[model samples]
Target: MDLRALTLLAGANSSGKSSVMQPLLLLKQTLHEDRYDPGPLKLDGPNVVFTDAGQFISQVAVGQRPRFEVSLGVGKDRGRLLYEPSAAGVTLSETGVSVGQAPEIIMRDGSVVSARETAVLLELPGLEAEGKNSIASRHGIAHEIPLVPWVSIAVVDGVLLKGSVEFPAVGWKTHLSNDLMRLIHLGGHRGNPSRRYPRSVSSSDLRPGVFHEQAAGVIAHWKQHDPASLDALQSAMRTVGLGWSIEPVDLDATAIDLRIGRTRETSRAARDLVSIADVGFGVSQSLPVLVALIDAKPGQLVYIEQPEIHLHPRAQVGVADLIVEASRRGARVVIETHSEIILTRIQYHVAKGTLPPKDVLVHWFACDPKTGDTTVTAVEPDAAGAFGDWPVDFAEVGERVDREYIEAAWKRQSGEAG
Candidate 1:
């Protein structure tokens, strides 16, 4: 995904949307939990949890292993892995790591090969890696065993993992790790309002979790340490039509709560009047999303599920405004939404010439009932706010509903007349 592009992922239920995102999330979860090196893949963690690799494998491709590929920075860095599903966890069969710095993997013996060919060369004796998170082993020629045991190579730091390549890296690091580490996720029980939140458990913590359990703390961090960022946060909140400015109140040293009140322009008093819990449920649900988007720095990826949840139809337009504005501000946004109003507003931006059509993409996913496979149809808005394909599933559903309703009404009217 382009760092500045606004991409929307939408589709029928269980049409493999989550499956596409889970691999990156798995990488994030694995790095987050340091208990094990987790050679190639992590089966369970906070973002996504699973007991067995078979749970992640495709049912149709029964004989094949559960494999995944990752490319970030527009394929500047990429990796591919094939793992054997096990009862306890998955084991990697072959792995490949490559980066864009030199466009080639430099070997210890001065033989340079294209990074793209690493996967095909995994079984053969070749160059190994050196340095921290690096591995070098020649099975027969060097009489060495595989360093990572399950996998051939794993690269976390592209530059740092560089040594003389004889074998691949041995650690759970990757060039994409930094991007994934900085990603912002807004989800879970954030819609559930509470009167107060804990100040913080860790001062250095950044991720707010799916429920945004760390949201209030992050807000307060900006308020105290980075007032300029807090201003941006407040500005973004106002843009979302929340009207009330955000203020963090300290109940004590250990507890904190957020308050929202109209600004001087909207109210006579600039003082915050009510806690976040006192607002409408829609406001509470939208708060975390706006926070996540606003908090995202330039080039930071923000993934939000159903951002328009619990919002009134009209208010969803504000969500569109936020999405467009975030992309313009250089924050990469990936929104998985089912709201027509939200999508329409974004389309309107393209139609109005306010946003470039090339910068906006809508991907519609559909599932084949018989085969259980998924396909993606992508489109970008034109000057008329028209995408080449139906951007949301509800459009067809609404038409079918209208047709069914009219048919039933006609049958009932004929019977009455007879």
Candidate 2:
């Protein structure tokens, strides 16, 4: 749930790892200019496609009208909005809004105060003023807002049942733009390699393409203007054991050939470059991931799904190095994966003090098949890099497979002896 650094989303097949990530993508697609006037939420888009609202709202949940909240936070400050499915998209209103200009609103001992003259009580929309104490707990903490000229003094009695600010709070917008808006998603299949990938110019400096269609052009961009960055990307490919260094050759004014060459074991033949299509699927699927991680600026978010897919076990472990490298470079890395090889290699780095355990987060998700409710648990690792709270289900299948193999081998040996 901490999207600031290295986070691993691991769980059962239907346990909602991707579900937690969807909201971020939902926000990304909404901001994407490619989709004409994508509303507050684009239900079906390139980042994540959905035909109906039912895919989002669960029937098993017992709420009269279930809604999902997309929360934004930076450091200790936070803002959240709740939305329900509306037609092909979603609908949301300004729930509770509080604006404080003096600085930050401080909350302590069930009393809220500000050193400055003004404190805006978050007024929840549509709720009539009634009980004060009972309604307080549902509200978000006193959030810091941008300096605005207009404000009136107000107070609510209850614990603040999820209030929304009226102006949408410029501070939250800036924070979102810095984090989720700048996020690069290398999820799902990155597409098959080709002889020439059409070049694309990115629309905004803040937002990269959610589908990552600009990766080839980005490589080409770096080659012409930022050779140092391109070198870093090539270094990353080696770190991931992909070993094939990338060369961007402009085919014409509108296209480029992303050639791959082997330079890991330097030789005369290593200098020869071939079309990316000549390499197998593994390199193609992972090229975007390396590109995102290496090219991301500090404080940007980069999310990848199954970073180890279509790779040998050794190469999978090398991906751990790349993830750690990207994180160390000040880019946040969020990965949804089932690759135990990559996970264990991360642990190895932590144990060797190459990475701090505090910098890494592992979330284990499990869903109740009958109820369809999902629960997430943080699997914490000790200083020794041992996950003491590792779930039984996580290890169960592996142990069972090992036991079955041993038993089968013993039976075969006994039959041969007889």
Candidate 3:
């Protein structure tokens, strides 16, 4: 199944829309087996901490472990590829493998193990020795995991962006590239209008970092004669009013770096000319995400949080446009947004027949402040981003008005209408 990039997840405040990001960003952490060696960042662990809007929404709940399940369609692979970690290393399974049998285990020993007796050795008790393979484990279970349409997700701040990557899982470490970082730091999301350095320097003196690396990737694609790729990259930057250009340079006298050029009129150029902190909060917040999307290769996945943050209504629409464009180019893009404008933009494209309606979904999460209980409501959008029907209190403007109106009506009925 080729995942569409133009997917949108929208809901009101504290609606758990952001909570959806938790599972996606914590994919490897949550789905892979216990022995998976979740890496130094250890994003997969129970204690992984995440902050959104200055609030702590850690994965490890005190006195309780938050549990959830994820499902996806199994494409050509017939849902064979699955990852579940146990006390041992990560385990891999195919459709033919029984859950009770010892899984093809990737062990801490750095060797792959696959023997019936070894299943018990790995501490995977659920494997019943001769039963159909099940997705369930100590953690949540996946109904299906597929290949072909690459899937990856990330959580930032509080937003979840789930999409397929152009590169393999191992490829992301390189695809992000170094040049992009330079672009981001030089006021990418800082939202400044003009460049202001904590230290003074000429534009030529600026070096490529995360922002620069991303921009370079974009420029490289543009140079490749791939129009769809170029269009997606340029459209994203243009939506935010930034410029783009690249040059080659020597790095540590060992290799040439793709030196990205900036012109504020163009998105890339603006970062060089302005300080991120000085720009509109929207600019500071959104541009880096835009660049990241543009630079993502066709088969790789990207996760972003709140691309709508600080963005004006118009720019919010622009962000949606960029996301959709990337998806059309074979990159799966998932986003968690609170902005109605962003949601509206998504619906607009769908309604206009420019994008697919089924590709995107809106989930509304309602969390009870008192109980800490969360309910997820899946919303399907028409082409116009309008809901098939707005649930009662979805926005609740009517309730607010009704309360005041009823109060006045009661007073009038009681002859108190002075």
Give the number of the best model, judged by lDDT: 2
In order, the Cα lDDT scores of the candidates are 0.64, 0.67, 0.44
Model 1 per-residue lDDT tens digits across residues 274-339 = 788888777778887876776777777787888888777766887788788888888888888888
Error in Å for residue 294 of model 2: 0.9
Task: Summarize candidate 3's per-residue lDDT along 200-280 as a digit string, tens digits.
Answer: 112331223223223433444345545665566555655655434333233343223343335535554634543343444
List the candidate numbers ranked by lDDT, top first: 2, 1, 3
How does residue 236 of candidate 2 score in lDDT?
75
Q: What TM-score does candidate 2 get on C-alpha atoms?
A: 0.79
Better of 2 and 3 by lDDT: 2
Off by over 4 Å in 2: 60-63, 97-170, 201-205, 263-271, 392-394
Off by over 4 Å in 1: 1-4, 35-39, 61-75, 101-175, 188-191, 201-211, 235-243, 262-272, 390-393, 399-418
* Clash number by candidate, in order: 11, 17, 73
Candidate 1 positional error at 364, Å = 0.9
How large an RMSD does model 2 have? 8.4
